[model samples]
Target: MKQWIFLVGAIISEVVATLSLKAGMDNSIFYIVVLIGYVLAFVFLTKALKSGMALGVAYGIWGACGVAMTAFLSHLIFNEPLTSIMVLGIVVIIAGVLMIELGSQAATRKEKGNV
Candidate 1:
């Protein structure tokens, strides 16, 4: 449970950092925010790993969610287009992440003789 919280924080932080990249390009303050966001993201990610979340599962979820959130937020914040094709791509990415998570859970269960 705690690990999941860390993972969530990491994902949100990464998304914020990524989104800030655009604003940071013109503002020094945003650049500092970007740096802090990324650093905190990695710190939380490390905490998640130390808390026993599998690396593959954690990283897959983080990357997928980060990409999806950043894209959606970008559309909102920067007036970027979110075309149907891009939406489809995001869905596919989410699906792939789900598959990875399921696979990780199955592998863990099997190792624990619960499968």
Candidate 2:
């Protein structure tokens, strides 16, 4: 769906922007990427919202994915620590996001008289 695409764009944009922040620390030019990325991220997020994605579900997914991807990429790109405890925390965050998504779906279904 268009909404999902927009949401994914938002997520990827956010991740890139976040990573750029670290890169920006070493070089100021990356700050331009950071600014553009964040701007596009919000734009995509707004599009996703307008396309009928529930705010709770969209935001939850965005935040969780951002955290997970940022952590993994940071480890790969910056040699940042990716310890076991952090991995476990990422898993937990993902699980919680899943629950939020499921709950949102259930609520939508109920509203539609499907339950």
Candidate 3:
């Protein structure tokens, strides 16, 4: 419950940090936000990992979701192109991440059953 929220927060912070990096490219002021956001992002990520979520699943979801969100944000904010192939790739990554999370959970459950 709270762990999921922390995960979500971490992802959002990562996205913000990336955006801030872009913004900081022109002005040094935004670098502060970028640094703070990155630190907070990792802090929340560590907390989420400690909250009993599978490492493989949590990291996979975090990475894939971050990539997807970054791509979408780049399109919206920077007017970056979004081709059909790119969209398909993002979707596939999302699906793969979900599969990894599910598989890890199933494996953990099975391991517990064995013990």
lDDT of 2 by residue, 1-115 (tens): 9999999999999999999999999999999999999999999999999999999899999999999999999999999999999999999999999999999889889999999
Worst 10 residues of 2 by lDDT: 100-109
Q: How many backbone clashes does candidate 2 have?
A: 0
Clashing residue pairs found in predicted model 1: none
Candidate 3 wrongly placed segments (more than 4 Å):
none
Per-residue lDDT over 19-49 for candidate 1, one digit per residue giving the tens place of the 0 to 100 score: 8999887886888879999999999999999
lDDT of 2 at 63: 98
Question: Given candidate 1, what's the lDDT at residue 19?
Answer: 88
Candidate with maximal lDDT? 2
Error of 3 at 18 (Å): 0.7
lDDT for position 74 in model 3: 86
Model 3 TM-score relative to the real fold: 0.92
Flag clash pairs in model 2: none
- Model 1, stretches more than 4 Å misplaced? none
- Cα lDDT tens digits for candidate 3, 20-81: 88888789999999999999899989999888777787788889999899999989987888
C-alpha positional error of residue 114 in candidate 1 after TM-score superposition, expressed in Å: 1.0
